[model samples]
Target: MDPFAPPPFGAPADLGEPDPRDRPARLAVGVVGAGRVGTALGEALDRAGHRVVAASAVSEQSRRRAAERLPDAALTSPQEVVAAADLVLLTVPDDALAELAGGLVATGADVAGKLVAHTSGRYGTAVLNPLTRAGGLPLALHPVMTFTGRPDDTGRLSGVSFGVTAPDPLRPVAEALVLEMGGEPVWIAEDRRALYHAALAGGANHLVTLVVEAMDLLRAAGVGEPGRMLGPLLGASLDNALRLGLDGLTGPVARGDAGTVADHVAELARVSPEGLRAYVALARLTADRALAAGLLKPEDAERLLEVLAD
Candidate 1:
């Protein structure tokens, strides 16, 4: 499975002309590091009617997988991939991005006049400096969604918001790229990239941690299938929260039930002492939200905070 090889999948659909906002030139797209994110994004662009001219992967396995999924796309070296495409997506890991960009520059992969982008949330256009200095317009366009290794991963990309950051001149192009992928584009300042990424991580990554902790507690409480027991409740609560916003909040804290809060704290301390800290932290945060929502009076919030703090 050479990561650099094009997938044996059927020919990709024709990506229409360059995004209408883009210069009338049809930009050749090159995907570097054909891993899950790269492959998924490539497929998405293909579906959007963009030309995915070439793709490269660091491993032979990835190359083969890429070949199977993007049979019409060329399998080549990272440098060659960039050279062949007018737009280059460096979807490699965060730590490896700088090295890969530097490698491409060292190999004289003239990135000048190219639209260079990466899917890293942790880095902004700075990581693409090597390419930018060589005349490329560097941009950071990260999709706020998860990707697995499946070829159909592109489906998850639809309707997702992409955090886009690029220079003034490149902003329109960056936004157009997001639209081309059927995603909403939100422009973020380069300096605020960390803050933007942190917010996403807090909601997505930490939510997963909170759910896992809840499941562990449930299992310890004699639940044979924690997920089955928690899934419906979690899903309904999430849906309600999204639909009704803060007004959808309910539960002991929202009702200012001090006794219930104390009981939860005591139970967490007894079952999972480490988890108690998280419970306390989240409760305190929720108390503030409840107060802001006018669901909890100031006094009630104070009382709840007292109980949560302990």
Candidate 2:
């Protein structure tokens, strides 16, 4: 069946998930926000053979993404998308998700019995209670990959984990969708959803900030190609850290080289006070963890702690 052509509306409801072989024709998907994430996912679902019927884009970038990634999907309002979809993906920002769902409810839209999912990492199904209370089936499906608002992003979804939170009866539905998108589904308890999201953000987002800060400092220190200079070191550090946990730590802190660490602190203090603060704080924490991991001796760490505190 052509996805642009809607499935006949009178099909009987099947609360259970559709079989993998029948999913493409059995469900009609809609996107409530045609931003980077929304378009990429719509493309993924479309690639998995699901029919993307419509999507809503409020900005030029979103509109362009929708045009590129979801060309056949009608550029329609959220209400229209909700009306036509058997499964509606609310992919707006975290701050706007609740309000958007509330708007859909307030408008008395026909969301009843439809599978409604949101791509908010910080929130679980609770943020979608407004929809569920109105008879919509709620599921939280936060993709654990970043989006670049590019057409090629759909390919990157393969093999990444998707943090899923749904009711027991709907677990299969959530997992099946993630699998359809070429992702692993990790069930996240609703209460621990925030922590799950925080771990991802700290690892991904904060890591990016840290790398950029290092690059800035390197450029200031007369390095012409900061990225080239740090790429191998950062990559090896990340690989070792993941493979060996805290035991993978290397550097002055891990070796408890107080003199070298104090030299770093003094140089950073002279050149960049902000960088010095960050260096000291991180080195202190690294030393603490190192000692606990038996990588640093008490006598060796004592002098390092004094330098870090100074």
Candidate 3:
């Protein structure tokens, strides 16, 4: 049960020349759900010299995709994929993962001696309970990167952080797989999986919402090309926030400009009522953060809050 020890399930028999990271011999890898994540990870592992034993997708579109990514890998049902490979990656939609696990276990697909992992960020090892009960090691290793349905997704695998959650018996294998995929592994407790996913959603998904709202505002103001004007500023602001921490925050909220805040809310209410609530909510949150950062005095923060609340 040593967290750093490799699992007994997927160890290769020959133990040939060690990989660059001195990992245990490459395991036969199988991928289920040949969507973007599955295809990308399969191709990256294949490129890293792992044996891609099998890959399967529920639809013809997914099968074609897996074929394009790993032409030599067998295409079969999910149960076949699980039975054929030493390590099975369930990359199906989060909602479908539990059912898939149950199906794999019901079919008696050698779960007892396999390493089972999933790309779902929401549920941890618990979603693979059927596999776990059958003695398969369950791991959640979600890559913190966006996936586009393109053959070149392998490139995006490099330099990403993978949120890894697994039992102590399976941690090393999960970490090694992350390394094999050119990603750094960040260990997370299984119980915190939902909270971790929520954080990611708030940051990545809501950032898109904020940007789209900005674009809409710009368009309403008659800007012909808002993206061109906003791109550099957005990039620089992100860079500064990352490098300088909270001290890098700028804008009316950071400056505690209550008048400007009121003006923005008023303008949005008049011109874009649909965006008003989001703008106010986000502004209030930013104001609180600004207050905590010492960028806004208490009185100014209070006034800004009042303006945003209105």
- By TM-score, is 1 or 3 better? 3
TM-score of each: 0.85, 0.91, 0.91
Better of 1 and 2 by TM-score: 2
Report the number of the highest-lDDT candidate: 2
C-alpha lDDT (0 to 100) for residue 190 of candidate 3: 84
Please tell me which model should have the higher lDDT, number 2 or number 3: 2
Task: Point out where model 1 deviates above 4 Å.
Answer: 1-25
Provide the overall lDDT of each model, using Cα atoms, as 2-decimal numbers: 0.82, 0.86, 0.84
C-alpha lDDT of residue 263 in model 1 = 95
Model 2 has a clash total of 0
Model 2 gets an lDDT of 0.86
lDDT of 1 at 228: 97
In model 2, where do residues sit more than 4 Å from their true spots?
A: 1-25
lDDT of 1 by residue, 197-243 (tens): 89988988998998999999988999999999999999999999889
Ten contiguous residues with the weakest lDDT in model 3: 2-11
TM-score, candidate number 2: 0.91
In candidate 3, position 234 carries an lDDT of: 97
Off by over 4 Å in 3: 1-25
Higher-scoring candidate on lDDT, 1 or 2: 2
| 11-104 per-residue lDDT for model 3 (tens digits) | 3333465552134566778998889999999888776667788988878788888888888789988888888887888998989988998988
Query: Cα deviation of 2 in candidate 2 (Å)?
Result: 30
